[model samples]
Target chain A: MEKSAGSVGKVVVDNISKSYDVGRLKEPVLDRCCLTLPAGQLTVLIGPSGCGKSTLINILAGYEKPDSGSITIDGAPVGGPSSDRLVVFQETALFPWMTTFENIVYGPTVQRERLRDEIEKDAAGLLETVGLREFRNKYPSQLSGGMQRRAELARAMINQPRLMLLDEPFRGLDAMTRELMQEYFLRLYEDKGQTSLFVTSEIDEAIFLADTLLLMSARPGRVIKSMPITLPRPRVPSMLTSTEYLRYKEEALDILHEEALKAFEGGSQAAADFVEAYEERETVG
Target chain B: MSLGATSTNAASNKSIPGQQVGEDWLYRAQRALTTPMPYLGIAGIAMFILFWYLTTEYFKLPRFVKLPGPVEVWTEFTNPDPIYGTSMYTFDYYKHIAWSSLRVMLAFALATGLGVPLGLYMGWKKKFKDYVFPIIEVLRPIPVLAWVPLAILMMPGREAPIIFLAFLAAFFATTLNAMLGVESIDESYFRASQCLGSTPWNVFKRVVVPGALPDIFTGLQIGVGVAWFSLVAAEMVSGEHGLGFLIWDSYVLSQYPVIVIAMVTLGLVGYVYSLLIRIVGRSLMRWTQKGQA
Candidate 1:
């Protein structure tokens, strides 16, 4: 659980491209997107609403296959869902019929038999950590939105995956709950040292949770920038009020704003130009 | 953390006052009484019987066509020889009741055992549904009574019509409900199961079966009621010893008391069967009471 630094557990995306047949013609959603996720760190992917941040997460989680290119996790070629890579979707994916305790223990019970007792113990402790031990016997419908999301997080972490994929995990929470959840995540991440890929539209969340931020263009999503956070952890709620956090937040917002305007005005043409520029820059560098 | 602590403290303080305990008890009692209609229905039946007794006995109507009092019925129930049979000294009313109950039980059990699994399969798999659903739809509109001629032609014996009628009554209802249950399952649930290294068989066993249980139980309840109705019709046509047969036989013999008793027994048996099915359903779906869905 000791925290490690740098690009130790590298994720290689080899010219990944994805397209959907939305109309009669196939429309490209993500075009030749290539990026490396650094090891033992939280990397945030930020973009506008329809910029395919979720698609990238789904591809990484093996929920959807890209039309072209390959993604390698650790060193193996990603084929399908595995215990090593776990996804906490934007939606609360907790089984409605299951109690909170059952949801948390599900992954562990499904994956490893020898670790059953240990997993149950760990699941109980996680419920306490998420402040849901009292509600453990309650079903998902009994919990509030925040509590459901917390249970989902605990469920995802129970399996102890090498790479955690969070797709807008705190999107619908109130402002206060969202801040508390971010702090809880930082604490858990510090304790576990799991590499994570987090997708979000919020600039402040990206700055707060990520060790390295990967800014993406609007559509046919390609990484526009990759900036490492100089801010130290454990990142507390007070860090949001810090001047350094504000500076990083401003930088992410500026990039997002320009992309949003271009997306609004030029549409697919702007996206094509952005991808061309991104590819050109990659070639030159 | 501060916000959560404040809310928890507020909730704990509210619990200590015990202000709502008496009111809560009263509310719960009222809710329990009103939630199930059968409790209220018993009171209604008592009132109706009281009115019947007063109108017939106290008002003193003509003896020939006078409303038969509950006392008379009670007397007839205890000593059935004069009222229930052609002979003045002998009547075997219990024999008819036993035979009727046996036929209903046999037919209902046969229908449920056959209908449920077939319904589950039709609902679960698309390929099975595509082939089977059309056939079910085609057969569904035809009433169980309408199948009497077909049953007579197709089946070898008299018992076959009775069983066939019960099966026809239940089959469509169970199948349709099972299909709805399967269709209504959350797609994400299946996806999640598949993603977690679950094979198709494991997914069906763990997720699909449990998810569809509530709907399936609902179908079973409806099926039982339908089966009882169909059993009555079947007995009316060709039964040798059943409540329906007793009613028809008593009518032919002009024994009005026996006919009324047979009708009452038929009603009571159907009501009891329905109540039993509901109890079974409620117990099986006890988790739903905890608000799982």
Candidate 2:
């Protein structure tokens, strides 16, 4: 295991801005969004729909470039995609033609940095870790939606990337499956302590999984608030009901509620839902 | 019957909604035989044959007066001493089948060999597509039969001209479909490949080829059918020993029953070619098959 120091995984996004030209109009998505993913920590980015969370992840993964401003990982300027930063896409991008084991072994085999036997051995362990050992021979289409996601995780993990970018990785899963996946993900993250940026829309999911929760403003998005969760390690379901957890949730909700109203004025549906959720929480509390 | 075989082969080794796992081919064949669809198809063919029989033999209608009855055609096709000098017992019947089949196979092979690579390159590179696509677009709309005269003029031998016509028909279909196949692949797959440390060449090898296979096979299927269609047309126009020539020669001799036999032979051979392509497609694309159970 090529174990580097924890400091090696720091990622810095400095004054990044991106926009798409929609016919005659220029649609600004990310407006000088700046944030840092500290080494050996999971940072959760939550915001309203169309808030450019995915765009940030895309830029971090080096799939797309920012209009102006730069991104760096551990002081080195990031260019195109490399094995150092692996992204688990929201829609499960496992190659349909390749089996689960084959997808997991793809990075090492293609890069040719590891021995063939060594790559296979590590891939086998990753498959086991992700609980997809039984489905090693199954293609992406053959696996269920959740199984496919797990297979993708294993595929990315085998590369031992310094930073992991998850673009709403558990978005479409059913409630029960989504909860289970979150726990499963936290377990893996705790074991490796790799720098991870998790982008999501769900408030509970953002609160439960993140070491630091960074909430962004509505479109032309930029990080508006960064709150560190002081809850103890090996977080449990019991923590959800704890006073400290509620305190943090309340603090986060207050900031998000203000931003949601700004978004609601601009005709955003997700912002309306957030306001509604905040009002319901206030009445109940 | 050939339609039933093709469908069954496509549905084979697949766990479709209504199909049972571990079911043998014989059992499926039995099911096909007993199905309402097959019965309806048989009845339809029987009705067509009955209409032909009534018009030519029973009614002796004025419009069908020149055409031979089903019985006469059948008898002539099966006879050891055919008056038309072409029958199941004659070596010339087999020779015609061989010539047509060989020419179509060669043309299809050549088209696939050249067209697939050309299309893949065109799809992969924007500059390559810009340089080549306009010529193909202009050439493709011109019918394969329209090239028959030019093909004969360009090529020296009878075989070359017929093969050239067939090749042109298959090439356009194959190349266009393969190009569309590459375009059909999702943008995310390419992004995923690049993120996983694949080089430009590896991306082409790993992402482009397999991702485009289903469409490539579709192209192959359409191409093979067109190859047969153009081969027959080419043979009919030029000097040849193929089934197309056999049909024309029988007509010139007024061996009307022999002409019907040749048409039937052509239909059977074309169906077999499509069935072969479908079977190969199924075998190569096991990943496309749904749940194993």
Candidate 3:
């Protein structure tokens, strides 16, 4: 509701670099990664394991500072975490002490920004939206993996953040559940046009939800490809098999395969077999 | 509800096997009751009592020649003015129980009151921990019994010394464990709390306190156990009208049966005290307990 036409919901990562000192050696994780996610777009970044995808999300969420670069959200410089930028962590980070409903209401209740009745109504709607109405009183540990992820989504969404940083938000969900969740997520964000940066390792998931698809290279990780997924909205399962989808998938896979080869840092038989086997597998779906 | 129909390749792999425990509650409880362990526990206690009786009285074994039998202790436990020099009838027995229970509760409550907040602050504030932790570490290792002399010298009255000793005994474990409780929290929870725009004070109240609860409960149980230990030791050495003094006085008079009565009474009371702590812990951590964790 607070959307400003020119500036709101835009994320600009400029020459951001980060490294962790392992003993005396500085292990470079992000190598001057630079990208701009346009306002109100869902951008997905896909890369091989340990390519600093999580680190990038953390930096964007203002949980960590880049070594020598700036990150701006909606023209304002990013500082330590604000309500405007919320992250859904990969690990089920729902407070173990709080129930699913309690977790969803935690943000506004803590900030005391809304009236009690408004918060209660919004919480009811959020729980309903995530299909967790019956599981409201259940603790995070009691919920199934998919349920926990949905609860976390509701928790983050209630904050109504300008930018949502999802660090593989659907990582461990069963494939069928993952598919359902993707559609559920797309439908939720479809009309809202909320800006989000989604990180993933799966190729299909990256293409399915992204307005802009950025394939990341191995660590020191950087954006290798910045292609747009021009697939039509309200995407059906059949579009996954379309020629345009396969064409986009093939180009993305080539970039990923090259990145994987580079990730290995040498000629390994497993790496060679991996890309070959991946390409040969029947259908992108 | 039927999200499992379309089996996923890697997606199914995301869920760790054996994470879900979907057994019926009644079935699980019935199954647990049917186990050999609970029956064995009851049988074990009966066998222990039988062994004590046989060795002391029935068999009159060489090792048990001097010790009082269970029968003698039981009889002496009821008599008003026993041969063992203890007045164990209605008023005398209740008086000792009341005194000891009163001292234990007061000391335990005081220790918890001071220890919990102290630990929470120490855990939350780095500067406070750095300044105080070394002193706490040094004092904790010195042992509560070792401080009996200092406690007596520090306080004037008999009641004050015993209470002081009990408080010190419980304080160290409660404080140290509460500190450890905060330290044990996962780093991600703190990050999550901060990202949600929680102020430092709110973080301390919401995240630090509740997050450290399970460990704090563990500390409370240990603290109460130590409080009993120190209370008895303090009463035994100094002038007092408590269970510990009764045990020592009976020992001095060589009233072995009365000593056993006091020991048994103390054991039953101490067991109940720890049980109370456990009951409180369960009620507080309903969110943690009902789940698999």
Q: Which has the greatest DockQ?
A: 2
Local accuracy of candidate 1 as per-residue lDDT tens digits, B180-250: 88778887777666565556665666566667878877887788778877877887887887777777887
User: Which runs of model 1 end up more than 4 angstroms from their true locations?
Assistant: A1-9, A266-285, B1-34, B38-82, B85-106, B257-260, B290-293
lDDT tens digits by residue: candidate 3, B71-150:
88777777766775564665766788889999999999998999988997888788999999999988888877888888
Q: What value of lDDT does candidate 1 attain over all alpha carbons?
A: 0.74
Q: What is the TM-score of model 1 when looking only at chain B?
A: 0.76
lDDT of 3 at A204: 85
Clashes of each: 0, 0, 2
- Ten residues in a row with the worst lDDT in model 2 chain A? A1-10
- lDDT to native, each model: 0.74, 0.85, 0.81
DockQ-derived CAPRI band for the predicted complex in model 3:
acceptable
lDDT of 1 at A149: 86
Q: Of 1 and 2, which scores higher on lDDT?
A: 2
Q: Candidate 1 on A163-240: residue-level lDDT in tens?
A: 888999999999999988887887777777788899987777889888899999878788888888888887877787
TM-score, every prediction:
0.82, 0.92, 0.88
Best by TM-score: 2
Ranked by TM-score from best down, the candidates are 2, 3, 1
